[model samples]
Target: MVPPAVESPNPQLTQQFLSSALSQRGPSALPYSEDTKWLIRHHLLSLTTSFPSLEPKTATFTHNDGRSVNLLQSDGTVPMPYQGVTYNIPVVIWLMESYPRHPPCVYVNPTRDMVIKRPHSHVNPSGLVSLPYLHNWIYPSSNLVDLVRALSLTFAADPPLFSQRRAPRTPPSHNPNPNPSPNFDSFSSGSSNPGAFSSGYSRPSIPPNNYPPSPYASGSGRVQPSPTTTTSHHGEDQSEVFKRNAINKLVEIVHGDVVGLRKTREGEMEGLFSVQGVLKQREDQLNKGLKGMRDEMEGLEQQLQMVLMNSDVIEGWLRDNQGKKFRSLENVEDAFECVDVLSKQMLDCTASDLAIEDTLYALDKAVQVGSVPFDQYLRSVRALSREQFFHRAMVAKVRAAQLQAQVANMASRNQHYAV
Candidate 1:
């Protein structure tokens, strides 16, 4: 027994869906691995959100041939430019299973007419790889609609960040001899010569110095800087990028350390002043004690001499009158106590002198080390500031380019309808 007849799948319908998905909304979200869809979808969504004015509408056109063509599903139609001239914009977003880990192939339309600026071309637009500004295209957790919107907006807006060219520089003329001070706009490098720089900008060599200057003490010649190397506004020959980075780093480091030292210095001053005051008091006390001890010692010597003389006289009397010998013994004991008091005063003075010297030494050491800590900390902070500055500039450039493109597209479209 044979089985009943079954209907066959319509090839035209399949083609239409595939074409619509590719041209209108980009690749199917279902066919793609979850990771691929998420990554691509997020980038597209962010691009669209940036421009609220534009909306996408679908249309279909079938040719005289039996083959029915849908703008999105069939061979994609070139979008009509704002001037009503047809500009072919063919973009394809396809994914591999190893995406994010491996970048997807993103075909940008209108490649022949599309002139992207330098530097930005180095980036991968998919945002899966670590390209400089590619991450701007992506957002977190997106859908297919999001990706289509991003692509549409991205094409509509041609931001200068993505276009790095500076007025499409012309190469130097090959017919003329290379000379110093070549004009940036018009220069001759002989017809056969390639551009000096990759961007085709003319960088002239330094002219020979007609007037020789005297040598300095270091025996270095007074060489004038080449105009080609020097910045137009500044005599410095450093690249703008390097200069910016250095400046940023320095500012950051200096500001941080200055603030820290201000706080630290206040605390340190209080302790130092207190220690200084104690030291001064000890010095004054030692001086006063020494003076008093000297006076007492001299008086004791004089008194002893008087006593000795008296004793001699009294001895003669004692022989005659025994009363004076007992009085002499008491006088000798009083003189010994006075000497003991003078010895203790001398020991105290020496101890005070040692304490003051130790304190002074410690304070000097602290001052020496504390002087440079703030400066060192400042230098470190400056380094960080420089890094931050560069990152900010890079991000800003990409954003600016994106905005420029969007504006340009809008203007073109508005002009188209005006006609």
Candidate 2:
């Protein structure tokens, strides 16, 4: 097609284009509004000057394993190995463009064969992969070099291992159960190194002459000398004797203070222990008393149950003994009728006895009236008969005699006449 031939990419132009592209994003990128030519020039200057100057050099760092590791920032990525762990390395600088404004990206590029248990881990708990001490770059209008240097030092120190490790927070106290576990923090032995022992550094040692008097010795107004005394052999070199005497007095005073402190502590501990023991004894007694009361209540309840059962039994027996038979009206009527019949029979017997007595009395009265004047009555009858008979005889005799007498009288008359 006889078209114009395409020109090859210019080294400068290619570099410029790549720089412009790289500088468009990120905090360390060049100004976004800059002209292409200026952008190219800016990127060119950064490549030729800034990048080589900024990168950390190869330095030997000692690891926890007693092994020395060579560290450096290289093209692509440099894998930092620590404690059988590998961390992805970040680019130190980009040659094409982006100045201080565009910090480079990092990747995990392992040159040596390694095992990564997890990816995208972090030193801080937030899991943010960050440049240490570079919080200022995160903000605007700050020195980026210092930030980079701090990041460099953090990397050199290999703080990921330690920063990831944290001491556990204090645990919550156990309650209700009241059996408190021992305080682990109080019992744990701390490392002896000053750096490890406390956040504050140890104070520098003072010389013997510079040492302050002991707090205990201060009350006695003197400082004690060491056993290795610095003095002449004289019993009393005035100054030396005075120093010794003052030291002895201070020692005595310190000893006395210690003795007092010990006594005070002992008394306080004894009082606490006694109070605890007394409270325990009172609690035990209260529990025992409650138990005794419960036992007594149970016993009383049992007795009450037995009494109720007995009452029920007795009631059942009484009901059975005094049952319907005894309560029947027919039986009661029969008993009353029997009593009336017996009363009537007794009355009849009494009437019969009274009638017998009257009959006997009548019989006795008839017998008394019918009884005779026996002999007098008999004599009267006999005499009446005899008197009649005798009267007849006398009449006859008189008649006879009269007849005779008449005869005689006649005779006698005759005789009398004769007389």
- Tens digit of per-residue lDDT, candidate 1, span 1-419: 01121223344554444444533443422333433343433333322232222222223433447653332211121121212121223444434334333433344422321223323333244321122223443222322333443443343333211111123333458436454444433322322122422333421222322111211101232333222212112232458446545644665566568669988999999999999999999999999999999999999986685566557656865586554344556566453232243344444444454554565455556557795465654664465556545545554565456446545755786799998
Per-residue error (Å), model 2, residue 35: 8.3
Per-residue lDDT of 1-419 in model 2, one digit per residue for the tens?
01122232345654555555445556544333343324234333333232222332233434458975332222322222222332233334322123233443222222211111132223333223366343334211222333333443444345222101113434345344443233423222333333433432232244523322221121223333322222112233578446645654665566568679999999999999999999999999999999999999999986685566557757876786563465556565453331244345544444454554565455556556875454554565465546545545554554455345444544554577666
Per-candidate count of clashing residue pairs (backbone under 3 Å): 32, 7
Question: Each prediction's Cα RMSD?
Answer: 41.2, 50.9
Lowest-sum lDDT 10-residue window in model 2: 108-117
Candidate No. with top lDDT: 2
| Model 1: per-residue Cα lDDT at residue 249 | 67
- The regions of model 1 sitting more than 4 angstroms off are 1-250, 262-270, 320-419
